[model samples]
Target: MDYLELAKTVGILTGISGGLALLMSIAQNTIGNYGEKEITINGEKKLIMDGGDTLLAGLIDNEVFLPSACGGKGTCGYCKCKVLSGGGQLLATETGLVTPEEAAEGIRLSCQLKVKEDIQIEIPQEYLDLKQWETVAYRIDDVTPTIKRVFLRLPEGEEINFKPGQYVQILAPEYQGNDEEVYRAYSIASSPSKKDEIELLIGYIPEGIATTYVHQHLKEGDTLNIIGPFGHFFYQDTDKPMIFVGSGTGIAPNLSILRYMQENDIQRPGIFLSAGRKIEDLPMKEEIDAIAADLPNIKMIWSVTGADPGTWDGPTEWVTDGLKKLVDDAKDSEAYLCGSPVTIEQIVDVLTEKGMTEDEIFYDKFQ
Candidate 1:
């Protein structure tokens, strides 16, 4: 090569080295600065965290995990905490999660509130009960064409104790195609009597991260990580006549409560109203029917919105339409409702028209 060409090549090499050094410096300034100011939480002092992260994350990183089902997505509304002082103004994303009274009380969704400034926050004592537990999948079976029942056994001699109707967050394992694990909450189907095994009735949402894992990727003997028996969607242990309404996998928790009542010989007149698009969607009917038959005061009603070609002889319209003629005197009844958001709202309206007070109806609005 000519001397002129060699000089040009040397100049290009020198420039490339300088450019790489500059890029490294910028990265160190941006990504490497995970250390920021010290923040106090509920009077306890903690180390300086990397600036720009949400307060919830910093708490989790410091081993004070918050009760967040949406993983900082700000959708579940379970991560709310009281920012006693120093926290900034609430972000727009947190508006839907907080009520006017709560806002006045200094309540904020920890996941939405960034810890740019050192701040103190208060969390519920019950929230401190939340913990991560590693479990093993003892069994996975297709309960229905659309629903699968997964039973996770806590390690031998281990216990996962929680109240009936509470839900647990199952961590979807990371696979080659997926980069991170995601949590999906499912109501515990197992009775509170069984403390070691956690059961879930999962409805398959096609190609959904957690559902797909439960439906296709998971298997017997595989280990799965899960967290908490959170949520308050169970039976209230009242003597009033009860109305149970569920559709799809929403039926899981209701069934557990019903079985518990039966085993304990708790006699209270009750009606279970289940709705489905087609006959196939109504799986576990025989078991539910048996429970109803064995319990003198328990009644079961099945309604199908979209009829099957040749088999259905039940109500032909929406499930709430069936409630019109059934719950004539809803004033004396306690209603438990679980289903999709739109369906639950419509059913609530019908229940209200039937004289059921808003306070008497307990519902878990699936988001």
Candidate 2:
């Protein structure tokens, strides 16, 4: 009644347990596997990518770099795309960023929308042509106490053909205590004419991943990976006079536009108003002055908000104030502004009050 009966019972129990374990392993693999999915863009192009990633990330992996100021954090609301079908449902984060009409029209924040299955999306044709470039940090110079001018040289046979005011995303590799890779966008300060080289005016935010990496860890000749030529903020072709405004590192894009205008001999009259906390905080003044000297129709004005009226030679007011003094009629002019959201909003209100319509003003709001 003893040994043989006990061994038989033990063998049966062990067999059942091993079968259950094998079944569980099969279920995990099947349920968790999100295999390849198709992404049809603009009803014309189709991409086959691995599923289970966000739409923003999938698009980036496929070499389509969308404009995302917050680097897929869903805060910038810049990576908006239209999903005709198969995007699942609207997320609260997406709803907060897009309006009701936009949501109804299939507009969604790409960063918040996951691609679990086949999907159809519509993006601008320009985005289809975007490319990721491999570059090297050729040089770094301190433009201001908090700003560093980093120059990047593209690899052989590679060149970035971006508009003057467009921006590029720099990859922040794992370093020090930060173990995850991330990206941050910075406007290209160098002219588009300089195809092989791009410059970024990066402002160091306390403990910022990309900025801190550039400021402290990134050295000349270090390899850098960047995806570029994003954003709609750029010089528009119009015969109407132009007004350019910027603050801090916001001057990066404006400088690119100005250089393009000067190099190409675009004779359209332009007035650049740059503001900073103090005179010393305004970087690239010499470069701006030299560009303005060659372009007779271009005028440069510098303003410092936190400077003493008696000591500073430049205007002791906001750049918008300097803008008001320079132009009397804003009705016929187009205004381009770049700065923090608050600063852009204030300048926009000023421009509107001066008779410029909302559509006449184009701005890039730094998040």
lDDT of each: 0.80, 0.87
In Å, residue 27's CA in model 2 sits off its true spot by 7.8
In candidate 2, residue 365 scores what lDDT? 86
TM-score of each: 0.87, 0.89
lDDT (10s digit) by residue, model 2, range 265-349: 8988878888888878999889789988988887888888888667687677787678767777889889989998888888888
All candidates: CA RMSD (Å)? 3.2, 3.8
Top TM-score: which candidate number? 2
lDDT of 1 by residue, 1-367 (tens): 9999999999999999999999999998877354585666657655566667887777766756566666568998978888888678878998998998999999999888877666777776665667777898888877679898888988778777777777888889887566777777788877888888878888888767788888888889999988787787777877999988887798887888887787788889988888888887886888788887777887888888878576888776666877877878788689888888898999889988888899888887665
Flag clash pairs in model 1.
34-50, 36-49
Q: Which stretch of 10 consecutive residues in model 2 shows the poorest summed lDDT? A: 308-317
Candidate 1 lDDT score at position 337: 86
